[model samples]
Target chain A: DTAVSQTPKYLVTQMGNDKSIKCEQNLGHDTMYWYKQDSKKFLKIMFSYNNKELIINETVPNRFSPKSPDKAHLNLHINSLELGDSAVYFCASSPKIVGVQYFGPGTRLTVT
Target chain B: AQSVTQPDIHITVSEGASLELRCNYSYGATPYLFWYVQSPGQGLQLLLKYFSGDTLVQGIKGFEAEFKRSQSSFNLRKPSVHWSDAAEYFCAVGARLNRDDKIIFGKGTRLHILP
Candidate 1:
């Protein structure tokens, strides 16, 4: 079984369009994270949620919001997408102790 | 703030050859280090991690890493390279200062294995 899973493996939308990516983890982990990998392959932590509480919010724009309904699910919603927002978005989960993180197949977002 | 650096952006190795990928980090206290691998069209996979105790840590797929506190480096090494090993490798650092102390990742090093 997939430990972590994300829906819509590929998303292509026009500028100003809003889209959401869903992530779920079956590992019974209490922490979930969203990371963005740009064209330069620079991976940056965008947000982190632990036990349904917002733990970390990076320097991402306000258009990006992360919602965690429960410990098992975390979703990312992006509004007014721009060309620069085109990149791969990854969802990962780890235990509360911050050990090895299990990641889901990334969702490639292309905003034209 | 903790950050990771992967000096080599790209590396090419022949199959059956030994491989070493360098990683460095800057932090005030002992940091939790990790090495992750990402294949094409896939999410990142944890190769190994070093939190404490012995400096040398072993990971899956015949991968290992040595942590050098003096040098503030954690380098991933493989005895023999395989064509399937070609992928992007990322080094990350985790801090304990905050509950949400997320893992900071390096830009990543792309490995190209020649058969």
Candidate 2:
């Protein structure tokens, strides 16, 4: 079984259009995270949720919001998306705070 | 703030050649460290990690890393390089972020295998 999965592996949308990326993990991990890889391939932590509680929110723009309905699912919603939003978004889950993280196949977002 | 650094942006090696990727981190305490690999159009995969105990940690795909506390480095080394191993390798440091912990990643080192 796929330990981690994400929906709409590739997303192409126009600027100003809102979109959402869904992530789910069957590993039963309590911590989930959202990371963004920019054009330069620099990976940065965007948001993190531990047991459905907002734990870490990096200096991400207000347009980006993460919603975790349960410990298994965490979705990212980008509003008023801009061209800079074009990047690969990855979702990861780990059982402990400092354990190895299992990552899902990222969703590549392209804002035209 | 804890951070990671991968000095080599790109590395190329012939098949069967030994490989070593450098990773350095800046943290006061003994930090949780990890090495991850990402292929084209794929998510990151954990190769290995070092939390404590033995400084030399073994990982899958015949890869291992040695944690040198004095150097603040956890470098990944492989006995032989395969074409399948060509990918972007990332080094990360686990640190506190607000109320929770966060894994800070370096820019990544792209590995190229030559036949």
Q: Ten residues in a row with the worst lDDT in model 2 chain A?
A: A94-103
Docking category of candidate 2? medium
TM-score of 1: 0.97
> In candidate 1, which residue ranges exceed 4 Å CA deviation?
none
lDDT (Cα, 0-100) at B20 in candidate 2: 99
Per-residue error (Å), model 1, residue B38: 0.5
Fold similarity of candidate 1's chain A to the true chain A, as a TM-score: 0.97
| Candidate 1 interface RMSD to the true structure | 1.3
Encode model 1's per-residue lDDT on B1-115: one tens digit a residue: 8989999999999999999999999999999999999998889999998989999999999999999999999999999999999999999998877776778889999999998
Question: What's the CA error at residue A70 for candidate 2, in Å?
Answer: 0.9
Worst 10-residue lDDT window, candidate 1 chain A: A95-104
lDDT per model, in order?
0.93, 0.93
Chain B alone, model 2: TM-score?
Answer: 0.96
